[model samples]
Target: MGIKESDIKQDAACTPGLSNFFLKDHPDENKWADCVHCGMCLESCPTYELTSQEQHSPRGRVHLIKSVAEGKITVNEQFMDPVFACLDCRACTTACPAGVDVGGLIEEARGQIRQAIPLTGLKGMVSKFFLKGLFPHQNRLNSLGSILRFYQKSGMQKVVRKTKLIKIMPQHLVDMEAIMPEVNKPVRKKYKNQNVIKSKGKTRNEVSFLTGCVMDVMFSDINEATINVLTRNGNDVIIPNKQTCCGALHVHAGDRETGRKLAKQNIEAFNDSDKVIVNAAGCGYALKEYPELFREDPEWHEKAEKFAAKVEDISKYLYDTGYEKPKTELNTRITYHDACHLAHGQGVRQEPRDILLDIPGVEMVHMPNSDRCCGSAGIYNITNPEMASAVLDSKMENVPEDVDMISMGNPGCMLQMAMGVQKHGRNQKIVHTIQLLDWAYQKEDGKEGL
Candidate 1:
């Protein structure tokens, strides 16, 4: 049966005073038009695969977003539903022969939603608080991180997990809630260099780490590990004080003004660095996309391009930086979960895998659709919990069984994958790529690298 014409929702769009569709400085229309719409993407779509909904399919959403972008379709709740529903996993792109860059389109759709309509619901508001509270400020997020850590250390988190509170919530909500690891220590000082010694020669490379909001507050150890790996590999790592939130949550949530400001801040903050080493795949992806985000302003556009050029997913950076094959053999089998941002947004295909393969004792097995999202797209898991969980459920089944550990590129994926491990009552561990790398570098016995 064909999609019913009456089922489509249409409404007058609220185009924010800036509507230059052909701005080259803005989003790339060439990338947007690359979708040939073959049904191959549907098979890998978790949302489509989960419910078999046509609207959830990558091809289906592409047409809608394309329609809205060209002003061919009215912007309304109907259009936004499918746009927001996307996990932005880039699994579809992985399967796309054309390399359509669906993740970029999804982000454009999100920018449209932010400007066109007021997406207000309880869920949307909670997302608002997360953007307002959890992101923008490093200080408050650290405090929250400390509290979560206290809850974990105090056994409250364990007790809560044991209880049915999450189950009482929506399935998706429970699924998202199920994924957060009890918090560890927060990163207190912004510029604390541990035991890493910089190479004495003309510096192999220089990079400034954007200790992103969630990265600073929640999974800080990953930051430490990133610093260790980069410096140990003979690069001078800088954690710039001027860096704030990467504005990923802002851009997705429709707050373009704040998003723009944050983009400019980051660009100027790390203006001097040759490479902006972003350990978190999501942040790296979003940071690189800022050129599109600020296409409207020439000055910012120039800066955004400059900034975007410098941005590097740490895994890709390390691989490009000449990481020698591991000296210590880690006699373990493992799986690598590619974050959507890294795989789809940045076109980072083999670098992370190549890095993992270089670990001598470690055998990195590719999970089916390793590029599929783990269902934690910024606040997507928290706000649209049900759909996120459904996507996560797909990931759970796709992972290989009996893996010693799982490595992922982003903090959100790491936490979500760890949660998935616990949900299945399995003993597998989760670690950032850098953490395991650092461990393997220092550990005499390979077991501890995880």
Candidate 2:
């Protein structure tokens, strides 16, 4: 029902040292008040499902944040765990009858942590490096990509494998490295002076493409497929060379200033295009929510709103544009895993599936709990390995036995699923939905797809 005065008194009494560390920032009270202590979100939360801890659930975390907001509790280590432990998959929001924005609240709470508490030691170092140093700078990120490509193609990887050097490294690191996709030459390199790519026929929609940091470096091929698929559907694609990373990872990790900086840069970069197409789910979610970053500044707020209005996930855009169904048949049984950001954050559920089912000879099987998080909540896999792996185990068990492929929209999901396939030694192919769509489209002309 509702929180009682007596229960609030009890909660205040239970948590000691409240005066020592006051919360300089907290999630909005109105948002926290939306939660009616309904346990409907429990089943949908990955951490709650694994540990069965009340504090790990959305409602419990809301209560904690509410207490902190009311000055009854402090923003300490104990409080940070409940807030950071959330996968931010937005599954709870999907399940909540009250429509409490759990993901937004968690992110806001994370922002509070970054502002008041601030991470230190290795976590702080790494966060500062990537959030500030790398992601916001396209040239530095591409250089790192080049180094990774060297590691992959310079025979160094072969030596590591042949010498059993991988044995010394953590299994997770080794597994992640093993499944690393061949790094294609960065899109900026391939399309050096090619900014605007005209449609094959009449141009239907002109859009700017966001080639995200990790997406461009590791899975550059996906960006290539995205461009091809858009042009195939009569979209004149504009590659904005100046557009930086969408600052999703930075925001998720609670670095608001950096996130906001990158948001401004992106808003400026894609200013000319009314339609900004993003294939990666995380990037799409962040780009669409850029307005949220500038809520307090009316001038930037209006600009951010206008910028976000142009953002669209590729599958959702394709389906909305009435994509042509491929005549070429790809005879295989496949299951679609909904990336949390694409399915829950962006509210894009059916478009990818609609595109998949439209393909000739493609059989779609319903995977149990297909919308559940695959434990790749941005950097959650690396930060919270045990919990991440536990959640991933639940996800992997839901895949159908005879499924030949697991198609999803996000790059993070693709990497996580690839890791799962490697761990279990399954013969399933993990690929992006657009990749598969591009393949089938190419098949019409007697070409094979990766």
Candidate 3:
């Protein structure tokens, strides 16, 4: 049923401390306390820009969350739609003058909603199969990747495409399949016997690498490139075997219990490592936010804070720690898209752009509203296709068509932007920022015939 004005008014009269959210990890009241109903975030919100609905706006959503805490609204379809529709891109938080954490509040509110009304039927089954059954387990992801590799290599993919059988699936999925990156053996599996990949020269730093679950499966090439770049620049990279998924997807999907479980596993997995290096922006941001998952537990929370402190995105890591600049010139005109998590979530805007600029013969074109959400907000394209498409459409308008390649940090953004390119009939190649650096180093090595 829809949230009625009278119902909200009636519930508002309830006791001050009472809450409609009965779950343990309900939305933190402190997050919304500073909102002040300011509309500063409205222009920054993609959904609000499209629908122009109050509930879809950041402050509006914050109001809804606050109302729930005040017993003015109950968790229902009325609450679920706006909350789930959110891209959680962290743009709103960036725009807020008061520095309100709309993303954190949305995630915590989702935790409450999931507990109050759990998913059932096909949606539940699929969600559970992927988030619970598949992600946290590395072997299963490898098996799935193997299957995909066979499909791509064994002529099944061509047959399905030629027969038009792929048209049976949703258009978005079909679009994604059309532009899907070739699946290869994960770096973790390739480097399983070897605990540490030694630096090319004298090692300057030793760091633990989180070869993320889906990242390793779908874009293992990028993972390989990241390691190559790290080692070439005098860093010995350590792959943590015990580490699994970073739990970003689970937390975004409102499965906080599973999110917490994965968080604990990762926290324990990388406990001994001094520095945790991540290539994927989503994974890095999720790793940094581990403390948020353990807010109620002091012991785990403290451990999580320490773990988070050591985590850094690969681009930022290389930039902060001086790396040898490639003498080889790439001569590639590339436009960089700021992955929302990398830019807004982690405040890592200039560091990556600076790294791109430092590359010899690489000309960087500025994408207008470069930090704008690309609608790939961690599988939002899969869940909310129409809005995602609209957001993608809006985002593509800002992408400079003149660039040879479109570079970004997150794999999800790469895939989503690939779809946008395909949908718009554009020819720009989608790539991770680290891949360009890797290519330059490879060229340098090739010139010397090393």
How far residue 352's Cα lies from its native spot in candidate 2, in Å, is 0.6
lDDT of 2 by residue, 1-450 (tens): 322334333333333433222233235556767789969999999999999999999999988877776566656678788899999999999999998988887888888666556778997898789888887887898899989889888999899999999989887778788888998788867886987888877888888888888888888999999988998889998888888889999889988778888999999998898899999998999988887788677899999999989889999899888787899899989999999999989899999999999989899999989999999889898888888888988898998879999999999988888888877778899989999899998998689864
TM-score of each: 0.85, 0.93, 0.96
lDDT of 1 by residue, 9-36 (tens): 3322224321322232233567667778
User: What ranking of all candidate models by lDDT puts the best one first?
Assistant: 3, 2, 1
The local lDDT score (0 to 100) that residue 124 gets in candidate 2 is: 87
User: Which candidate number would show the highest TM-score if scored against the true structure?
Assistant: 3
Clash number for candidate 1: 6
Q: List all candidate RMSDs to the true structure.
A: 4.8, 4.9, 2.9
The predicted structure with the larger lDDT, 2 or 3, is 3
Per-residue lDDT of 354 in model 2: 91
Better of 1 and 2 by TM-score: 2
- lDDT for model 1 comes to 0.74
Model 3 clash pairs? none
**Top model number, lDDT:** 3
Question: What's each prediction's clash count?
Answer: 6, 0, 0
> Which of the predicted structures, 1 or 3, would earn the higher TM-score when compared with the native?
3
